[model samples]
Target: MRTSFSQYIRFQKRLLILYAAIMVFISIMLYVEPTMSIHFSNLLYIHAVALIFLMAYLTIDYYTIAKHHKELSSRWSNGMFIQDGIGAAKTYEQQLYLEMLQSVNDAHQQQLTSILQDKKESMEFMTTWFHDIKTPIAISRLILEQAKENPDNESILEEISRIERSVNQALYFTRTDHFARDYFISRTELDTIVKSVVKQFAKEFIRRKIKVDLHIQPVVVETDSKWIVYSLSEFVSNALKYSNDGGTITFISEEDSGEVRLSIKDEGIGIPQQDIRRVFQLGFTGTNGRVNRKSTGMGLYIAKKILDKVGHRVTISSKEKLYTIVTVHFRKGDDYYSIVK
Candidate 1:
């Protein structure tokens, strides 16, 4: 807290020594050579007075520096660096530094805000586009449903179902960032969600002659219903895509230790051993996808993402050319968080 004045006083040893030498020389001259001046006594008296004044001046100066230093130090610490009481009200150099730092902070804050705004706008546009495009897909599905009486419309209906699934995937992917605000978490029955997903794929199941073994126990778990359904649908879609005619796809659920495990097992050409560990990677199409040519490689990736956000775990076990099982484990007391990427 010591000011420039106090620092100079403490550090001016050379000046003090020079003053002491001069005082000694004058006192010696006045005392030993009284004849050198008729006013030698007067000279000695004046010298004594000057010495007293110098001591008084230095004492007052030190007190001023210490007092100023204490006041400024307290203000500097508590004023958050930019308070006018600390900088602008002080000297010009301090005010200049304060303004420079403030400018940099403001610019940095503005840039961060701009980046977030752009990302939000882009997500909003994607959501709107997905919704708008669904209107046409819905009309097509309705037309295909009416044409079900005609034997020739089976293929078209199946194709439209695929299109609907793709659109749903995109819609959910866009909404992932807004899950905390968009989701409604509650006690949802496993059977209900499984049944809805199966119903959506009824046409594909029928065409492939695939059998569904649903052993869901109507067990209620706490989670976002819509998102859980979407995740289940992805597994079902994968099962249907890879399973052969007359093959069985099983949806089974069981609860243990206040946790529920839902498994979707299919007797499809399972993922190759080499690619099994990497199936969850975004846009990673493995050996099956290479063969099918229709795999976007996003189904399981998005499923794992949504499930992970809701505190659910997804894992896969498979034997190439035999079977594949995708399991979702739901736990208790998972609260939703609006995490930013």
Candidate 2:
């Protein structure tokens, strides 16, 4: 109310000046024409009455401004459209400003829509290109497998495998943005995914002479199996990358109290204490990543995003130079169904 009154007074400064000028002219006329004898008290009374009426007019105008301001605030607070919220304008200038605002808003919305369409088209093109290139990669791998198993061929095959991993990583990263369209949630076996991921990384295991210690039991949970496999593959890949030759990598699974947990513990170079907190951050390669030179820094980030989307939890614990443990937790409940829906 005070704010509206202050605004009203500021806007009516010209009217106030004209009222003061009229009073000054009347005072001069009364003083010069002594024949029209108006007493001092009567002149004071007249001035008081005029002031009362002026104050009454100002009070009514202030109330009107205050009511308009309150209505505007209420409409905005309730999330009403700006054009409708402003209500009918009382002046031509106010109407003009409202029209101008609507024009700018329309232009802004149109530009935003165009930019989103362009982005959607670009993502679709990249996704198609990745799928097309994977066909050639698979054929090459097949051709090499059927050929004689020479050292040169094995090396070439390893390079091809690396390329395939990179392509899969890029493809999955792009799809994360549109995950709602591609996923189907169902009850999937946990050990099956673990075994499949371990098999996928068999070459890396053989090349590095790393021992696999599996202590997995039959465990099942509700999830999108494809995404779970990809996320687990990323974790296994990280384990293989940092493990020393002939070192031990353990895969442990446990189900208790309606909760399932899968843990991958590696006796490799563990994460630095300072770097542990930011390991999942996008493109953040810590001390180990810099030494390894193969870490794209998107593996953990992508895995975490997929896990979060599927309503699972992943955590990491490590002591530098000792061991690193990555664990994924799946809670058993109907809430899992709510995630995809």
Candidate 3:
């Protein structure tokens, strides 16, 4: 926007002093023509042309410098200058721009880091809170059992038991995200753990008139007992949830190569082909879940998480109208032979 030489010029004081010195030298040369030049007219003409060219060059240079400075200033105003131009800030404009950009980027990064830290802290708090709440729930269940004989409020007791189960599910779901920290690998008795979990569902099996077929041998393997128990429990619970009254559920364990596999099969309303793969996703309740509104869709997700932590894998297969089978494969290690022996 600055068109004139004086308007675009910077360091005005220095430019003016230099111009004045040049003019004074030229004037002195003209006055002492006898000593400086024989043809004074031609000399004066040449000097005038040289001074005009010098002024024109200065004006053009001033405009180029001013245009770049304006651009730099606009970029700073819009907060777009977030990195230096890979060189030292030589100009006054460049120095200001570099400092502004560095400050903006530093503040932005700090804010992002603080937000992430807050989220991590919140999740940690929830995990601890859920763990602490479970102790009281278990104690309350014990107290209710002791008092059940005196009162005829069977429904109330059942509801309390359901609450306890829901709380357990929630706690397990919360812990799934931190599974690596909780797993402890050791030799675990397959038969004992399976029997214990089956016993927990005895009342449901009886109430539904469902039969259980246990084809388990005294198999042992190196794994996390708590996680394995929970995983197997989830499979069994799912079987019970979908199986018709009088349907049979089968529990089997076998050894092959260097590994052990446990499977749960149920004569239930089987999953559709499309839904089998998605069942393990968090909060993904399939079509059957829509029919059975009580499904939280967290069970299998937590089961998979627990299994993976202890180096185990789970697979699901189902026949549309007949049955669903869940198989757990435990990894073989040096401890397997010793435990089986």
Arranged by TM-score, best first: 2, 1, 3
State the C-alpha lDDT per candidate. 0.81, 0.87, 0.79
Top lDDT prediction, candidate number: 2
What lDDT score goes with residue 273 in model 1?
Answer: 90
Candidate 2 regions exceeding 4 Å error are: 1-86, 90-93
lDDT tens digits, residues 203-274, model 1? 778878899998988688878888889998999888888888999999889888768999999998998899
Question: Candidate 2 on 262-303: residue-level lDDT in tens?
Answer: 999999899999999899999998999898797889999999
Which 10-residue span in candidate 1 carries the lowest summed lDDT?
A: 81-90
lDDT of 3 by residue, 254-298 (tens): 898877889899999999999999999989999999988868888
Which candidate should be chosen as best, given TM-score against the real structure? 2
Task: Please give the distance, in angstroms, between residue 165's alpha carbon in candidate 2 and its true position after superposition.
Answer: 1.5
Please state the error at residue 166 of candidate 1 in Å. 0.9
TM-score of each: 0.68, 0.84, 0.65
Write down the worst ten-residue block by lDDT for model 3: 332-341
Clashes in model 1: which pairs? none
Clashing pairs in 3: none
Q: State how far residue 330 of model 2 sits from its true place (Å).
A: 1.2
